[model samples]
Target: MRTNKNPSEPRFLFLITKPSLQSTLLLQALKKRFYNEVTLKHCDVIDSSTIEDGDLLLFDMMSLEEQTSRQWCQDLQNCQKKFKTLLFNIPPHYHHRDIVEWPMISGIFHTETGEENLIEGIRTVCRGEKFFPKSINDYLTQQLNLSHPQWNETVDLTHREKQILSKLRQGASNIEIAHLLFISENTVKTHIYNLFKKLSVKNRTQAVFWANKYLR
Candidate 1:
């Protein structure tokens, strides 16, 4: 509904795995309707260093192999600079939830999602909130709730850890959280490691789910 575009808005970059009519139409629709800086690059040849902070990568999962897509997401997670990753063109019947396991994934746009819903999801993701469908959210919730409640009583998170956990819930990257908390990136990682151990969670998504259930 908000048609006005700002120059400072997060740039949308489409990472095309394979050229298709659907990909072209999606790009054209995004360019015409929502963003001023929407652009496309082949995922195979994209230079990870060129993706800057505040840029969102929309990966076309329609053509990408699952393992290959996970590798790209993992690579993005390992980058020094913070960036948002969104998977689009996901088939409606996609049963693999492992791809969403990456904390770098801020959103997903299914092939069945309408244009308006896609645009809305992108806008929600740009605003720093995860845009997962209810089904994905429920999946994560179930995965995390399997843990014992006694662990929550033994775990005591520091103030900084709590802050970082909150940031993780909002889908912030380590680099982004560091900049936000005025701490060094290494410091952020250290705290994250400590907290992850304390919480008995392995990654950001699990940490966030723990925070959701345990943190007040």
Candidate 2:
């Protein structure tokens, strides 16, 4: 499918939003700041026909109701869209750590900010850089360390593998793990296989019993 391609000029961005006054304010500020420097579009979402390469998606994600936001984040992991998605808000309570927040926002410019800061965030994200609010930096660090144990400097298992095991230990099925991890069921099986091979286990039940053994 043909996207709004213009590689020679400024990058393109699309917003698939549920719509809110705060989102509207942010979009208006972005437009005013980078009128000629960027191309913008609005869609209901990056669906089967949506998303193109070199395009960054600015999701007014928090504008959605809580249950909707959770479901949307779930879909994003499984979505076939090729562009990178940056959610506007991180969950106030986080249970995962591998996800980075700084790459999503640069300098906590509010919808109240007029043109300058809004343009900065757009250009920053468009260039594949993220800016975060100064106020949230410490929180990011605290949350990162709380998710899973880090052995030496690296995770004992790759984050994906560890994530699946975590859910498995919690008694989730492969299908449930896949949905929670935003991976396909086949991929989940592959991860399970690799985990078995890596841990020298024969099956899921064994993996669960042995998962924490590698932590220390």
Candidate 3:
């Protein structure tokens, strides 16, 4: 994800909790292989001009140091207009919500992450996409295996919206959805827009993600 559409362009900022020569080495390792496509620097998130540009800010902060990180996120949220932040929080506490739950933070990684996870997370972050790893998902699934999940996605779903999304889940196109529901194609578009808005998703992929996650 450090690689941009233009190879010469860099799209990331590496924010370290405490700067050191060791971190300098890590920066060299990060950028050496990614081509001339990223700017890596050791910085304190508190007073970083590098972090203010709405670029991805990779923090190597810890959860025990929560207030500082929250202030850092609040600052980013206030100043940045358009960006996705990727946070790298170390072990013993992955619940660094102050930053990770910010709309700016599009992805998060644990200290124990592998190369594949890091790569995929960066890619997803660049696309403004959200990702929860299977290990995290598996851990959550075990704790929350209590009972049925109440599907409230359909609460705002109009009778027609539910029917429309059901058709969508069945892989129906606008023409097919129109025909199946006995509505015009134009009306179908209106309903589809409503579905997208009601579900708070801009595209079909997110709609499907929300549907499969909560509606199913």
Best by TM-score: 1
lDDT of each: 0.74, 0.53, 0.57
Task: Kindly list the per-residue Cα lDDT of model 1 for residues 56-155, writing each as its tens digit.
Answer: 7888777777667667766676565567778878886776466566547789888878889988888888777999888888876766673755345457
Q: Flag the better candidate by lDDT, 1 or 3.
A: 1
Please give the lDDT score for candidate 3: 0.57
Stronger candidate by TM-score (1 vs 3): 1
Candidate 1, run of 10 with poorest lDDT: 1-10
Across residues 22-141, which tens digit of lDDT does each residue of candidate 2 receive? 567756765555453333444344352454455566655445555655555455444433455555544455322323421222334333444565456656666656565654556555
* Candidate 3 local lDDT, residue 99: 32
Writing each residue's lDDT as its tens digit, candidate 3 over 76-157 gives: 5334234555666556445533333444446667778765676667666655566665664564454333232431354467
Index of the highest-lDDT prediction: 1
Off by over 4 Å in 2: 1-10, 18-49, 87-115, 145-216
**How does each model score on TM-score?**
0.69, 0.50, 0.51
Against the true structure, candidate 2 reaches a TM-score of: 0.50
